[model samples]
Target: MLKTWQRCTSCCLGNKHKGDFMHIYAIGDLHLSGEPPTKPMEIFGEHWRGHKEKIRQHWLETVKADDTVIICGDISWAMSLEEAAQDLDWLAQLPGRKLLLRGNHDYWWTSLAKMQKRFGEHFEFLQNGCIMVDNIAVCGTRGWLLPSAEAFSAEDEKIYRREAIRLELSLQAAAKQKPAAIIAAFHYPPLFARTEHTAFTNLLHNYGVQHCLYGHLHGENHISAFEGLREGIRYKLVSCDTQGFQLYKII
Candidate 1:
């Protein structure tokens, strides 16, 4: 049986009353390629054929204006802000308040100020900040490559530490909100090895974060994904491809 929205939310947060207040959904790795210059994801895999349409159909069916969608990252394939406009516009037309986090492939995300100026409240960026809706606090930052990744290097370690600090900052902001629960979103996996905890997971554990949403990993990489309960945190992978182009209802 398909899980009801209310049931899922209540299960994740352990609060039936707060879950009734709002519906929260999450999906990432949109990779929306609009117009001619943008490269469609179909070029990489047969699974991506008509993916955008599938996403639109499922999203319109599952989400509502009052709900919130946490887009875990890789939202667009545009090379520049100008090129990303069409893709961004399409996202704005979708239901609910879209909270955007940065993915590794998001090259057009050079400036938060410019993005805010362009789309206004239609899209909310989740870098170094957190937003509260109903009794849930949403927080996150662009995560970095794990040490287990083949491309990991000394330079990558610098970024890894930096991203950890940024995650801390975002979590701190969420803590300040005093929400009933904190749902941390990430563009990168918190742990490379599912069984081993990393600095990112440790911080979340320290802050009492019980639910974490992330993307980036796909295909065979899914085997390494850390899901279910671990050390009091529930981690879930919400990449669009992994979720079958449907929104993963978080609340």
Candidate 2:
């Protein structure tokens, strides 16, 4: 039987395993223990309604204790890390070793150093950082959205430019280590337009990211979301809107 789960305003994913191979399971924009009917719910509600048990059931059923799980962002609504610690503890109880990245709504995320130290025991966070599990290297950023589809004002361009720098920094850190297969992640789609002129894409291509994952878009957007390989890079949109997270075979 599948394991049952409970919800909490503060959640922290658990990270621990006693296995040889490292498996990666991913989910994004969980917005768990947050204001109800908020963005996360708008995206995953239809599927999650009266189904919290089902979602948790899926997690306990699908993931093994030794697997590596990545929660892309929007983890909680705490105003500070201390408050976050309360929520993070909830995430710690579930199975697996968990990795986390920042999300757009993560208003309380302090310096990555501080957050890492606080949650170091249960969660490993990537902020312009990299880590190796079972020899597979994982690197990621709280990637920002490119102003595609619509034209951007000067201010919008400035914001986009700033995020571009941050993204590159994260990539640079990951590249320095030269992991076997670069697994890049973000909260937004690095390429949502036809033009490959975007800064995020430029960096991704430059780093030769083997696989990229992202989340954020929800609702009807999930249907139109991109999934599969583009060129040599395999990109998968792992938003919770897509029913549930995915189990990736890195081999």
Candidate 3:
């Protein structure tokens, strides 16, 4: 169950007070495979057995067609775009406009133009870019593992720096729009379990981002993820399992 602070009353179904307000919600690490799931996440835990239905039910109950849902990453298990069609179609049938960030497991992801053309306007992919949601700007990239991680290698450092540049580019683009607020999303946590800060967190702070949402941590690793207010910015982990497969309202 969600704590009181994590719950939003304004976005519930049939709420008369919700007039003209477009709510934004987030959840990530969907790990969906086509209908006959080739990669059942149940192997991770029994809690994932019927996750798709759980997500759909909660989503329908929370999000409206005009609302926006940001999916942080690991959206599908398919190895290629052609193989991911079924999974993509499943998401298309869900309510709300979705903004997707690439996950490490999302090998099916190709160029942004190809994905945009294939999916149309309903699904927007974020990669070194920002999307305007009402007066707010949503910006992000597939953040890599922090250098502080014990397993970090030379190659990991290369990817980490590249992702940092991408994040800066996205933030710069969002800054240009001068939106009322900025929200940064990522597939990997910006900081390590014990580390206080990293390049990713610094970029966020420099850009004056208000909230940061990320996933990728799961099961026993959940305890290590950092959350709550830090340097005036709020960070939250939105992995599907962590949220009990429900969409978290983010204003």
Tell me which of candidates 1 and 3 scores higher on TM-score.
3
Model 2 lDDT tens row, 1-251: 11111221012112222324446778776666532323344343567563334455667877778788878787776668886665577678778888898888777789867876888889898776676765456777776656664666778778778877777777667666645556777887777633455777677777777678888887777565567777567777777656554344433
Q: lDDT at 113 for candidate 2?
A: 76
Kindly report which residue stretches of model 2 are placed more than 4 angstroms away from their true locations once superposed: 1-20, 34-44, 50-52, 149-151, 194-197, 245-251
Per-structure clash totals for the candidates: 0, 9, 0
Instruction: Tell me the tens digit of each residue's lDDT in model 3 across 1-251.
Output: 11112223344322533477788899999999988889898999999999999999999999999899999999998998889889999899998999999999999999887898889766999988899987678999999988777899999999999999999999889878766678899999997554477888888888888889999999989898888888867899999999999998888
> In candidate 2, what residue range of length 10 has the lowest lDDT sum?
1-10
Model 2 residue 230 distance off true place after TM-score fit, in angstroms: 0.8
Q: Tens-digit lDDT track for model 1 on 69-166?
A: 99999989888888889999998998898899999989999788898898876988998988887668898988888877788999999999999999
Better of 1 and 2 by lDDT: 1
Q: Which has the higher TM-score value, candidate number 1 or candidate number 2? A: 1
TM-score of each: 0.90, 0.79, 0.91
Best by lDDT: 3
- Candidate 2, clashing residue pairs? 10-87, 11-87, 11-88, 12-88, 12-91, 12-92, 13-91, 15-97, 16-97
Residue 77's lDDT within candidate 2 is 65
In candidate 2, position 56 carries an lDDT of: 58
